[model samples]
Target: MSGPDRVAGRTALVTGAGNGLGRAIAHALSAAGARVILVGRTLGKLEAVAAELGGDSRVAACDTSQPAEVDELRAVLSDEDVSILVNNAGIAGPVRELVDVEPAEWDEVFAVNVRGVYLMCRAFLPAMIARGGGDVINVASVSGKRPLARRTPYTASKMAVLGLTITLAHEVGEHGVLVNCLSPGPVAGPRMARNFRLEAERTGVTSAEAERAFVSRAALPRMVTEEEVGAAAVAMLRMSGLTGADIDLSAGMIGR
Candidate 1:
């Protein structure tokens, strides 16, 4: 089949766009002609990306976990008419056994992965439905599908996202809004590198060795790429008939 049509004239709000997959998605959307809004906590990083996108791009620096800040963000965007919302802001926090995990750490994970997406959807979905139709892509993880060894908080947060996506898809499908979760297996990005580094520190291995070990667990025996995930997000956004589905861009690891 031919590639999806360019999203020209559409406006997209991408959170966690300061780096990694979110940044890649923002670039892809901008290149596809969407008027992109880069949202993240770091103004300098967001501004740098905004500068690269050039046309009709804006940056909003707000911590997604804060409802008041999200409200301010909504007020700032009240007139922009956003047609796409990508809830990509997330945190892995510290890896620890569930029994040993602190309540505060769990809350932090939920704050960004679950609550942040909830806030973004609540703020943007109305405008999208009002404008006729739109796409909402929540960036989840393979951890959401099944438990990982020491990622209790991260896993829980992503599972919540998956549930949220399904629930919202049902609520908004008739209104022409598509909601879905994009679960990527270990993508080769800054975030993945950080995760690997943390694992290496915990396991007493070199970072390179740690990454190699982790990639070996994947069916493809290789790490996925940010561009690949970005492409999947584009595909999901264009899939008008698809909703409430967990799209796995996992490089053959889902069933394995």
Candidate 2:
């Protein structure tokens, strides 16, 4: 796809670009003419994604949850004018009842999903503001706004992202920055497959049955694809006037 030209010359830094939705978003941004920077905890994975983009695309290894690592990452790319920041690095915490969740596990979830966003924005937003404008797209989830049994950590972290996106928009808009979030539903991928298997084991049902129940709850009766989520991110980037908004790319299941 020739993609949109709005971001053609911009540089976009996408955390978690090593795989899944993050990888998809990196590709979409590259195709839209942005010089993509693939950032993640795994060096090899990030390098692989950068190779795929095969241009001015670069790679940086950083565990966003770690403040030191994020600071170093900012230093590493200090020369690059990153006009877009995609905060997509995240992990699925253990799926279990709230009572069964460990405090450390809950902290781990918030560290990556919530604190990671805070650290990235803190590191990059000043530069963006100095340059006079930028775009930030935080990858949240539909589970944040809806009830998802046995996923308190993940859901709560995502809900925090929603709140962060809107309020951050309020704080940064005066500096010409646009901050928004994309809340995707069950995206068809290995991650969702693992979730299905876990749910099946917990509920004493087959994985297929678990998957069916999930998709069946959506108005479209299907899971959204990673590519769709990636495309949505690019679309959000192209919307120049949009800010403080949560775009639900949940296959019509958002309100259900």
Candidate 3:
């Protein structure tokens, strides 16, 4: 049970598995013996990750924002046994003031972050319930718990995810499905790098300076890693009795 044998018989569907936290979680689950289905908009990136993992790893190119694409993805997975579902695909757009943000951009953010999660759950949860039990992990953010200035779209979408997680957990608890959310703090991923660059442009500061300022807001004064978030996801999947819980993997940032 040292390697893939631990999760050998399990199947996992990870959205946004092309990079960042989703990629890390896919790798982790695969290492633990799960057959990972990597879903993302980029086939090349997903295939690259699948090749690296080997052994039952699959790539499904999907723009989660599109309902038809999501339905097709569900049809593609119709015959598979998926034990774990990680709703990790998301976007952190420009940090614009509420009034200054374009309406379309705001809608797009919710389309991916909120609607995508809902569609995935709708597509997979029935099978999971029929099979007796499964785990669903939503990758929310600290902003979901507290309001952050200049990121109305991202924050609002994450909040919606938190609500969805809670309701789904309650709905499926008796059926043996576990639904929970992990609110990660400022993790040093490509998204964070992009956010930093945007901040630099906004304030006329260097990217390095913006990153430093961003990290300073954290109580730990350091960014969390993808492996750390993956570990939390693994824990959630392994916990049979937990549901409707918001596990904060923020390195003690929320209360402070």
Clashes of each: 0, 0, 2
Off by over 4 Å in 3: 1-8
Candidate 1 structure quality by residue, lDDT tens digits, 65-179: 8999999999998889888899999987877788999989989999999999999999889987886688899999998887588898898889989999999999998888888
Predicted structure 2: clash tally: 0
Give the alpha carbon lDDT tens digit for every residue of 1-256 in model 2.
Answer: 1234558889999999999999999999999889999999999999988888899899999999999999999999999998899999999999999999999999999999999999999999999899889999999999999899999999999999999999999999999999999999889999999999998988899999999998998889999998999999989888888899999988888873
Regarding TM-score, does 1 or 3 come out ahead? 1
After superposition, the stretches of candidate 1 with alpha carbons farther than 4 Å from their true spots are 1-6
Consecutive 10-residue window with the lowest summed lDDT within model 3: 1-10
lDDT of 2: 0.93
Better of 1 and 2 by TM-score: 2
lDDT of each: 0.87, 0.93, 0.87
In model 3, residue pairs whose N, Cα or C atoms come closer than 3 Å (at least 3 residues apart or on different chains), thus clashing, are 4-33, 7-33
| Model 1, residue pairs in steric clash | none
TM-score of 2: 0.97
Model 3 agreement with the true structure over 1-256: per-residue lDDT tens digits: 1232325578899999999999999988887678899999999999999998998788899998888998899899888888789999998865889999999999999999999999999889999899888889999999877867799999999999999999989999888888999899788777778888888998999999998887777678788899999878887776667789999887666874
Number of the top lDDT candidate: 2
